[model samples]
Target: MSVAVYIAVMAGVTYLIRVIPFAMVRKKIKSEFIKSLLYYMPYAILSAMTFPAIFYSTGNTVTAGVGTVTAIVLAYFDLPLIAVAISAAAAAFGVGFLV
Candidate 1:
């Protein structure tokens, strides 16, 4: 297929996937469980996408693991996001240098 045609088809498919859900769901969702699930879906999806990437982001799995643990610990303590990120990166870099 031509590149232009392929791009157009893909765009249409993507648009339809997003649009059809809105078009079909005309009524306000009433169930508390369903509403809660929808509210948290984005966070769940983000974590699902991000958690795996964290393991492979550093050059070595060991370094990545250290970074992830550091981040988790800092986050658990309610540290600022910047602090968590910096500490994690520093830990990963330090571990990388050692290993």
Candidate 2:
């Protein structure tokens, strides 16, 4: 019920999440399937966390969608990160004014 209790519970859960893996896997992993799963897990988790937030970030789905599309297009073209970010923000800002 208290904040300290919540924080302590969270800390215990986080510690277990990190420790359980190390405790379970002591030898080099030989399975390609498992290896690939581990390799892609971070990206999958990051996308899962990030994708939904993108649509709600600007408080307007239209502007957020425009910005997301702009970012995706620029990233696909392998544009510089700075250019992609600024262009996305500008696109979102301009769309915000219109919509």
lDDT for each candidate structure? 0.93, 0.94
Clashing pairs in 1: none
Q: Write the per-residue lDDT of candidate 2 for residues 8-85, one digit (tens) a residue.
A: 999999999999878886788899999999999999998998799999988999999999999999999999999999
RMSD of 1: 4.1
lDDT of 1: 0.93
Highest TM-score: which candidate? Answer: 2
Clashing pairs in 2: none
TM-score per candidate, in order? Answer: 0.67, 0.68
Off by over 4 Å in 2: 1-26
Q: What would the TM-score be for candidate 1 when compared with the true structure?
A: 0.67
Relative to the true structure, candidate 2 reaches a TM of 0.68
